[model samples]
Target chain A: MKYTEEHEWLRVEGDLVVVGITEHAAEQLGDVVFVELPELETQVAKGDEVCVIESVKAASDILAPCDGEIVAVNDALSDAPGMVNDDPQGDAWFFKMKLDDMSVLDDFMSEDEYKAFIG
Target chain B: MAEGGQNGDLQRTVLHDLHLDLGAKMVPFAGYAMPVQYKPGVMAEHLHTRAQAGLFDVSHMGQVILRGEAAAAALERLVPVDLQGLAEGRQRYAMFTDERGGILDDLMVANRGDHLFLVVNAACKEADIAHMRAHMDGVTVTPVTDRALIALQGPLAEAALAALVPGVAAMRFMDVATYDWDGAALWVSRSGYTGEDGFEISVPEPCAGAFARALLARPEVAPIGLGARDSLRLEAGLCLYGNDITRDTTPVEAALGWAIQKVRRRGGAREGGFPGADVILRQLETGPERRRVGLRPEGRAPMRAGTQLFADDTADTPVGTVTSGAYGPSIEAPMSMGYLPAALSATGTQVFGELRGKRHPARVVDLPFRPAGYRK
Candidate 1:
């Protein structure tokens, strides 16, 4: 698993990578009320806003961490957005993407580095 | 993002440490480090208030005492409310209007027998106090800095409070009374911003922490924060001081004509003595060009404040802008309140709100998406 400064976490599973916000980001957002995900097969560049998460207080953009083509978007989040707050890294994974460049993943922070960065 | 104090030095409320102790997410609000939400988060807190009771630390709000032989008369000159006939132990919602008929601030004025107790927004308190001091004569405005305010709101508020203070259950909506709690005198009022049956209690600063703890100990009571407070008030269709109403907005334009009782209207006995009376009374006689109305967007994406509104999806000219908006938990949809031309302000009028640079269909609906649960 790797973390981005924007607080999203990515985990490699076979040829696809699952994306979701970190626990710290979920806690900061308070409660997730709505989630707008990107369409399947849409190509996204690193740092592009691929999704939006709306909480009771405000709306925040979820940016892409690595250039990839969207493979599967989380359909479950459409009915239960609070899953992001309840299990941010697991079932709450926003989407799965087919990585176009594995080299881009090296730029992300390790778990320890991410913890230090937030602190 | 929260706005810190002007000079970078954030002020702390009396319940600052208590909030931290409860793992509250503290953020700067109105120059104070206030809790935006606790561990349960804003959504839960909002639902809790609607179902049960929630305690809010509103100590940042300004409390003042206006005292003089002609205090009521002096107050009438600044606000449009008819205070001369306001009986003791009653409260009224009022605003300070400028010479041009714009709202400077909206406040609550409670007649406490010998003096009038005024509660103003934290951000506008300094200017409100100075404005009152400069304009009024024969009255002394004293800021009550040693007191902290706590709001106990929801269906269970009366029962929760009655357990702590015996006579609180009998107080009707808008009733104000003084009660003794733990040897401290508490000024309790059956009024709140959530459109619920609630009480706002003003306790001495030193006792605020203990008082809040005692209330939280009740089975129905939970500690809420500013985030829930804003959402609750928005769901209730209440105006937030700087957001919904501002120096550029007027009561008439904000759909607050009911607050300007008939006693202060053009044909009233006390016709037009307050500041901006000419313009305000004129608007009262003939409606304002634009009025505030509730907006219900058609999708799940929340249309937030600052979102522009157009008459139609293809219209080039924007008709209005959203002032306060959020996904209302009680209403179970994305709701907002914004200003629109009087013709387009009618309920069921089709409109479009520009979100993420695209116009989305919406409708102008009657305010207060959720029914008020006040114990009237």
Candidate 2:
């Protein structure tokens, strides 16, 4: 699992980023409901929030993990909001950006580090 | 639920581990450990679900079972709804009335035959139980504190839940069912607080984990905390008991006269025992001094609860106070709900709210700033 201090997680593929809310964060939220992902092709900078997710009682912004232009947004969220709550690591992913700074991963937590950091 | 470490901490919920791992901002609510907001903040969370679907953990709410043949009659005496007319597998919104005619609390009354299932507000759970016990003599009232309640609401709720609970599309609004899935028994209701198509599920606390996992596995769901729940409910034009209706306000005055079925008005058999009946019924016929209405703030400024409202057509004398208001997400504007003089409660009435001693123009609108998604 890839991580950010904001508790977002990403599963990186060859050159694409698969993003979703972290398990620790999803549990904290109690139940996931609504997610507003940025539109595809939107330009984003590292550390800038790109989308928002709302639960029954609260709303939160999902930050862009790396500087780049968004390539694909998870539109599925519009029709299936519980996706975030039900599959925070999978379909709940917000959007994927073409990494503007590939080295930015160095600032994010690795699976092991994220686990320890949470503890 | 937070586990007590000799610090009076309560036990945590099934999702507690995930919440802490996600760096959730935790807070205390209704005697349990829960999240108030996450990193993205409360305002945004509140907005997102209005425009989308929001999930909520209202497990803190009190669920109770009233058993025995006396249950229906006993419950009817406590509330104003026509319990005898409520069909099985249906839920109705009601209030516990004081003979003096004030609302003790608002509750969801579900008739399951031989039992009346009630899901009450978390803050008033203790008082509700005490009030029920104080009034009833023979019925058994058991608080099902071990149940977890989850609400999934929004326009998209249908598609998200359809695949999981097949044929739920056939479930009409306000319908309830006993769901058997993944080895757990879930009391599922096609009902929710948010003014949207949705579902509220009650599962055994320990079994909540499995049910939640299955629901989350579906793509449309997300974990929404308490912060969004308030905003969504406000946008939906629903009332939060302490903030809107209280012992001081009669049902008729609060625009809840419709909730009191005509059968219990005094002529019905076994009538008038509930508190505040005479005053409420009289107000029902004569009208209240003040009634609740929606306010559309003219500008971007969001008026908060307790803010005073004045007649925009007149001098600065106050006419009402905001009870619940917010910057609506779906409408993309600032709006509020509050009580105003019944004579001036008509829609299109010119009104203004006070901010920093200055007044801003407002318009009186119907309650439910947003349209209701009742399963009709």
Candidate 3:
């Protein structure tokens, strides 16, 4: 699993990067209750903020880690928001994108690097 | 009740491991390591539950079962509700009181044939038991501290639950019954704090993990932390026990006097007892000195609780304090509720909320800034 300093992950399948929050971030945010996915075709630059997520206590914006056109969003979040909490690195993919530039991948930490950064 | 073992005064629930597995953001809530938010964040959690379903693990709350022939009579002495009239399988929201009518705690009393089940708030559970135990002679108050509570709330709650229990869909609001789920004796109740259609399931603490896992396994089920729970209830215009209603605030002033059934007021079936009956009855008769009302800010800036409210008619002088306020996701406007002097608490009455060293235009309106979708 690939990771970011922001505690997000992108499971890469060749060129398509599926993104979601990391377990550490999920642990701090608490229960995954609600989610909002941005529209498809929305342009998002790496480091650009898009989408939004909420728990019972606070609201936060889901930042876009990689620049790409929004290709897909987890629509199931509307019904099962806890997916983001229970499986932050797995089923809770916020949006999928074809990275704006492959080099933006260099800015993110690998799973090993992420563990050290969090500590 | 194995309610023993405190992690050096840092209380941890039995399902702490389960919460960690789910990546819950654990924090100190009512003395337990509880989730405040999840990966989806608080705002999204709030809105999603309003539109869909959200599950909350509130097992930290205290549960008690009162046993005795005079159990209802003992309860009536402590609370204002007509306990004798409450049939089995039904619940009544009532408040424990002192001789002087001070609210000790708010609770839900459920009649389970021979026994009365009481659900008390987490922070005040110990005090409730102590007070109840001291007052009763024959009544035996057994704390069901070994139980875990899970609430599945929202419009889809009934459907999701019906998939587990075939008869649950037929249960209306405030009803309760046992459900068959994975060998766990789940006491399912059509009740929730979010003011939405939902169910509160009580299970044996030992089986809580399995039950939670089963619910989490469903594609539609998601774990909702405390953050979303607060926002959802706030949007629904439901008051938080401590933040909104306290010992100092009366039901009438908090706009909760309607919950007091009229039959109990005139000493009909259960009467002339319970603390605060005099002051509570007076409020019902003469109306309240101050009434809880909703405030709508003219600007997008959020006005929070404790923010002073000013009446324009009084040259913008302060008249109230915001008890609870938030940017209502459903209403799409900054909404607040507080106790305002009765005369100025009318609909369309213009007012202002002091926000960040500046006064913002506001108006009092009929509460519930957003339409509540409670399953009737």
Candidate 4:
């Protein structure tokens, strides 16, 4: 698993990368009321905004970590956005991305590095 | 993101340490470090307020005393409420109008027998004080800095508060009374913004924390933060000073005409004596071009404030703009308040709110999304 400065976590599963916001980010957002996920199969570049998370306080964007194509999205989030707050790191994974170069994941921060970065 | 960088410039209320102890997420509001939510978060706090009781630290709001024998008559020259007709121990909602018929600030005026007690918005208090002092003569506008204001609101508010002050149980909605608690004189009004049966207690600054802790000691009462307070008021269809009603919005346009009594209207005994009487009264008779209306969006996604409303999906120009929008925890739906042209402001009218470059359908509804639980 790898983390980005934007507080998103990426885990490699076979050839796909599952993306979701970290528990710290979810805790900061309080309660998630809505989540606007990207369309399946949409191509996105690094740093491009891919999803929008709306909490009771305000709305925030989840940027794409690397150049990839969205392969699958968690439709359950559309029905129960609160799941993001309940299980941000586990079942609340936002989407699965097919990265063009799998080696790009090595450049991201490790779990310890991300924790220190948040501090 | 939470407020920082200007920490030195922000002020703290009397309950600051208490909020910190309760694990409140403090945020900057109107130049004060106010708690936006406690450990329960906004959703739970909102629901808790509706289900039981929620104590709010509203000390940041400006409390003032208008003294002298001619205070009521002098105040009549500013707001459009029937101040003279207001009986002692009663309060009325009023707004100071500008020369252009726009609202300068909205406040609560309570007749305290010896003087009038006014509670104005925190952001507009300084300007409101200056405006009152500049216009009204023979009346002393004394800013009360030694008092802290706290509101206990909910369906069980009376039960929780009556436990502390037995006299509060006898007070009806909008009734004001003075009571002694722990050697402190508490000026309490049976009024709140949550549309619930509640009381706003003005306590001496030194004892404010103890008073709040006493209320919180009750099983029905919990400390709610500014975030839940906002959502509760929004669900109740009440206006935030800077949001729903502004200096550019009039009483009629903001659907606040109900607050203006007949005695202050056209052809009444004390008509046209207040500021912007010409335009406000004219709008009162003929109606304004735009009107504030409640909205229910079609989806779970909230069409937040500043979202432009159009007549349809393809309109080039917006017909209105959302002022307050949130997911109402009690109502279990996304509700909003915004302004629209009179022709398109009817209930059930279809409108489109542009969000994320897509036009989402929303229906125009009546002012309050939920029924008020006032004890009146």
Candidate 5:
């Protein structure tokens, strides 16, 4: 798993990368009430807003960590967005994207470095 | 800026340290460092208030005592409410209107027998006091800076508070009484911002911490923060002074005409003494062009303040603006309040909210997304 300064995380699996916000971001957002994901097959540039996460307090934009083509989105979030707060890194993955360039992963932060950056 | 005490040098409430000690996420709010939420978060706090009781540190609100033989009459000059008929031990919601029929600030006025007790918004308190002082004579507007205001709100509020002050249980909604608790004079009112049966207690600053602790010690009571407070009031369709109702909005346009009793309306005995009487009364008679209404977004995306409302999904012309909005826990959806043309203010009128550059479908429903659970 890798993290971006925007608080989103990506886990690479074969040619696709699963994306979701980190636990720290989820905690800061309080309870997740809604999640809006990019449609499948949409092209996304690095740092592009790929999704939106709405909490009880405010709405936050979720940016893409790397250039990719949106492959799949977690349909379960529409019915139960709280899954992001309950399991941010697992079943709560926002979308799966086919990476345009795996080399962009080099810019991502490791777990320890991400924790230090947030601290 | 986030809602804790953010912008400049922040003031601390009496419960400031207690909030920090409880691991509350403090933010800037109305020039004061206030808890936005605690470890349990806003959703839990909101649901807790509806199910049980939640204690709130509303000490940032300004408390004042108006003392004089002409106290009620003097107050009647600034607000449209019929203060003369307000019985002793009862409180009414009122607004300080400007000469142009715009709201200066919304406040609570309690007829405390010999004197009237007033609670105004924290952000506008200083200006409200100065406005009152400059406009009125004979009555002395005494700002009670030494007292801290706390709200014990929810369904279990009565039971939780009753355990501490046995006499409180006997009081009905809107009732105000002074009680002696732990040797301190506790002025409590059975009213709150959340549409729930609750009490707002004015405790001496020194005893505020201890008093709050005592209430939190109850099994049914938990400490809530400003975040939950805003969400709760939004769900209740209660206006936030700066957000929902502002100096640019009139009582009629804001749907707060009910606060003005019939005695102050067109043909009443005391019809036109208040600040914006001419325009307000005219609006009351002819109706305002735009009115505030509740909006239920068709999707899960929450449309926050400043989100523009369009008459159609094409989103060409803007018809209104959302003023206060949040995901109401009890209502289980994203609810908002906004100003719309009176023609479009009917229940089930389809509208669209422009959020994040996209138009989301919404309906102009009745005010209060949830039914008020006040104990009358």
Candidate 6:
């Protein structure tokens, strides 16, 4: 697993990379009230804003970590956005992206580096 | 959510230490390091306030006393409220108006028999004080700095508060009185920002911590923060300063005409003595071109402040704009209030709020998404 500077986590599985926010990001957002996920099979760039996360306090955007096509999205978040706060890195995984090269994940921070970055 | 850092210059309220102890996320608001939420977060705090009692630290808000025999009459020249006719031990919502009829600040003016006690918004306190002193000749405008204001709000507020101050239960909504708390005198008002049965207590600075701790000792009471307070007031359809109402928004346009008593109207006994009487009175008779109304967003996503409203999805120009918007915990929906053309401000009117570049459907509902539970 790797972490992006925007507090997003990426994990490689088969040909897809699962993307979700880190626990620190979820905690910073307070309570998750609404989540707007990206459409499936949509092409996205590294800096493209693909999703939106709304907490009780304010709204925030989720940026794409790398060039990829969104293949799957967690539809369950629409009905229960609080899951993002409960299990951000697990069940709250926002989307699965089909990346051209999974090796791009190596450029992201490691788990220990991410912890120090947040600290 | 970025936890706010303690800015060295920001002011700290009397309950600052207590909030930190309760695991509050402190944020800088109106020059004060106030808590935005506690350990339970905004959603839980909001729900808690609706079901039980939530204690709020509002010590940063300005409290002032207007003395002299002509205080009420003098205050009448600034606000549209009928302060002169307000019975002793009662409070009324009021606003200071500018020459252009725009609201300077909204306030609560209570008749304390010997003097009028006014509670003004924290951000506008300094300016409001200056405006009062400049306009109200012969009346002494004295700021109360040695007191801390706290609000115990919710359905169970009365029971929880009565446990500490037994006299509060007998007081009706909007009523004000002073009671003995230990060795200190507490100025209590059966009023609050949340649309719940509650009390706002002004305790001596020294006793504020003890008073707050005592209230939280009750099982029904929880420590709420600014985030919940905003959501609660938004659900109540209450106007927030600098948001729903501002220096550019008039009372008539803001749908605050109800706060202007009939006695101060054009045909009443004391007519048009206040500032901006010419324009405000005319607008009162013939309705303003634009008016404030409640907006109910279609989906789960909140139509927050600054979201533009259009008559249709394809409209290039915005027909209205949202002022205060949030996810209302009590109503379990996204709620907002904004200004729209009088023709488009009716209930059931369909409007589009532009969020994230996409126009989503919203309805122009009546003010206050939730019915007030005040103990009248």
DockQ of each: 0.67, 0.06, 0.12, 0.84, 0.69, 0.84
Report the lDDT tens digits of candidate 4 across residue range B1-376: 4434555679999999999999998888999999989998999999999999999999999999999888999999998889999999999999999988899999999999999999999999999999999988999999999999999999999999888889899999999989999999999999999978899999999999999999999999999999999899999999999899998999999999999899999989999788888989999999999999999999898988999999999989999999999998888889999999999999999999999999999999997899899988
In candidate 3, stretches whose alpha carbon ends up further than 4 angstroms from where it belongs are: A1-119, B1-9, B267-269, B313-317
Q: lDDT per prediction? A: 0.91, 0.77, 0.78, 0.94, 0.91, 0.94
**Candidate 4 docking classification:** high
Model 2 / residue A40 / CA error / Å: 40
lDDT tens digits, residue span A29-102, model 5: 88999988899999989879888889987788888788879999999998899999999989999999999889
As a TM-score, model 2 comes out at: 0.73
TM-score of chain B of each: 0.98, 0.92, 0.93, 0.98, 0.98, 0.99
- Comparing 1 and 4 on lDDT, the stronger one: 4
User: Local error of candidate 5 at B260, Å?
Assistant: 1.0
Question: Candidate 3 lDDT, tens digit per residue, A1-48?
Answer: 678777788787677788888888876665544566788888887677
lDDT of 5 by residue, B170-191 (tens): 8989999999889889999999
Q: Clashes in model 6: which pairs?
A: A28-B1, A29-B1
What is the fnat score of candidate 6?
Answer: 0.91
Q: State the lDDT at B212 in candidate 6.
A: 93
Alpha-carbon shift of residue A105 in model 4 (angstroms): 0.3
By the TM-score metric, which is better: model 1 or model 5? 5
| Fnat for the candidates in order | 0.73, 0.09, 0.23, 0.82, 0.82, 0.91
RMSD of each: 1.8, 10.7, 9.3, 1.0, 1.4, 0.9
Off by over 4 Å in 1: B1-8
Would you list the clashing residue pairs of candidate 4?
none
Q: What is the lDDT of residue B135 in candidate 6?
A: 84
Error of model 4, residue A58, in angstroms: 0.7
Better of 3 and 6 by TM-score: 6
**Candidate 3 at residue B168, lDDT?**
87
C-alpha lDDT of residue A103 in model 3? 68
Estimate the TM-score of every prediction: 0.96, 0.73, 0.75, 0.99, 0.98, 0.99
TM-score of chain B of 3: 0.93
Give the distance in Å from residue B299's predicted Cα in candidate 6 to where it truly belongs: 1.0
**Which regions in candidate 6 have their CA more than 4 angstroms from the true location?**
none
